[model samples]
Target: MSHPPMRRPPIFPITEAQLVSLFMQSFAFGVHALVFAVCMHRWFCRFQIAGLGTKSWPWMVVATSLFILGGVDVSLNLYDNIIAFVFFKRPGGADLQFETISNWINIVRSVLYFLVAMLSDAALIYRCWIVYAHWKPRWAVIVLPTLLWLGAIVCATVDVYYVSTLHKLATIPHEKTLRPYLFATYLMSLLLNFLVTGLIVYRMRALSKQTSSFIRQQRWNRLKTVSRIFMESALMYTLSVVISAVMEMISNDAFYGTTDVSVELAGIAFDLIIIRLWTENTREESRTITESFIMEPPPARPRLNSLGHYQLRFPPPPSRVSFAHSERGSVHTNISKVRRI
Candidate 1:
């Protein structure tokens, strides 16, 4: 049997500069992940769970746990990205085959991140709705969350499709067409994330302004504060978005470095920061509620009102007043007679 012609080895085309950048990105991701995990855990334990106890302790626990899970999932992605950079380079073929096993690993990891991102987004959406709550249509509430969940699903689908296809792009030859589509998908997902967060902030402000009730206003202010934290956390991802856009323009590996390492790390950091903020605020809210109850006096009963003073027990009404003029006249007559004598 004739042996097949020896094929040229795949080139992993990269320079020392690119390797250095990738390493820097990996280091940044690792450090951020560790920091986030530690800080977020502390935050959840200290503030989030305890704070949530005021409104709905059970739900708060669920949300806090979910938030932590999301943080951890993203951290895992950062780790995977670092590993991929270390072992796999585009120019030089990695010892491990790209399509055979690596693709599967990436797919699984991406799925996890997808779930996490979706859950975090959903949690935020739920909280926003809670804050904006009133006589809103049932369908409206259902629709918003459903839409957000759909966005998450779409993002995950696109991520899986494109990331998995990346390995077979060489063999399939048609994979080049998918690149723009992949970019579009990522952009859409990012946009959705930004838009959803923006909506929450906007709604909170609007509700705050429209409400006439003092109680509602107080709640709205709390939501507004939370929204601010959320926005700040989101600002980190905004950097990621900008960096990713610039990278897309440059087509340089360094740009990729920003998205995978720096941006990811930054996003994780913001998440932990927000979690801490939420925890602190929750504790403060609970304290405020407790203190208010302790300080306020109970309403007095209506029966407590007396003619002269307020009392708890009922009292008889005052009797009518009568003049004592005859007695005064008799006393004056006796004094006049004595003076004449």
Candidate 2:
């Protein structure tokens, strides 16, 4: 008689899943580092060209903080993995180490993740505000998103408190008390990102329409290009949060992997916008220079007159017209006639 296959031990999946998460986290960290480097290079180039300013300082600080926090978070994850796989000499193996709710490294990683999410969301809101700054009631546009961000802050604080208070070694699935706060935090962030991104995109589209009549077709195309970039970057972070929230709700071990990726992706999303904008600005400047050179007028050639002397012919000056708008909204046009001697 054929024997039934032996069942796998509970520890098998825990160890395997954690290992997968560790590998994925490391790979993402590599990408994050490379992006961070490029971002810094672009920022420095901009600084050199434009010189130091208050507005530029804030962006540099934010990008640097995000990179530092991401690095620390990934390092803590690495330490936890090493402890679970190599140093922990216990009967339960890696599962015991991973399931320990009170692990210090795990607690720190959770806090870092929450911090990064908040920072990224705040940056998105700032971008939205900047885009709408010219509107009469600009603040009204971001009120809802700002409120959602505050709610997220409260949820994240509570979640961190709960995680810190857990004294026992237990599986995450069994922690019913913490699920609501965690879910709320992720849900709020998801909504905030959606709203902010939508608002920015709508504003861009509106501007495109408003300027279509007066602006060059090339400029309209540039606006579309910018809108596309913003959407692509925002979508990257939004999808990561969506996957994370879904995984967290289901209590899947894969949540660890996705959450790890989300941390790096948050920074990547923010930095990507700056990098792409800088590139676009550079391309536009180059194109402008090329057009100026191509459209430049040719030098006037010297002509030999009947007196055998070289003479240069100059073009006649054009008349000028100026428009003035009165307080009552009436426009007055004045034409200046050019007189030739």
Q: Which candidate is the best by lDDT?
A: 2
**TM-scores for the candidates:** 0.56, 0.85
Clashes of 2: 0
Please provide, for model 2 over 1-341, each residue's C-alpha lDDT reduced to its tens digit, 9 standing for 90 to 100: 99999965553365776788788888988998999899889777766654433346676688888989989988888888899999999898888899887678778888999999999888888877777755669799999999999999999898878887887766554478788998899889988988888887787777667656644577556667777888999899889888977876776777788888899998888888878866777676688789767666567779999999999975544433222343311111100000000
The lDDT of each candidate is: 0.51, 0.77
RMSD of each: 19.4, 7.8
Worst lDDT run of 10 residues, candidate 1, spans: 332-341
Q: Could you tally the backbone clashes for each prediction?
A: 7, 0
Candidate 2 stretches with Cα past 4 Å from truth are 1-12, 51-54, 303-311, 315-341
lDDT by residue (51-85, candidate 1, tens digit) is 33344343445444544554554455445445555
Worst 10 residues of 2 by lDDT: 332-341
- Clashing pairs for model 1 are 11-91, 11-92, 12-91, 12-92, 13-91, 13-92, 304-311
The top-ranked prediction according to TM-score is 2
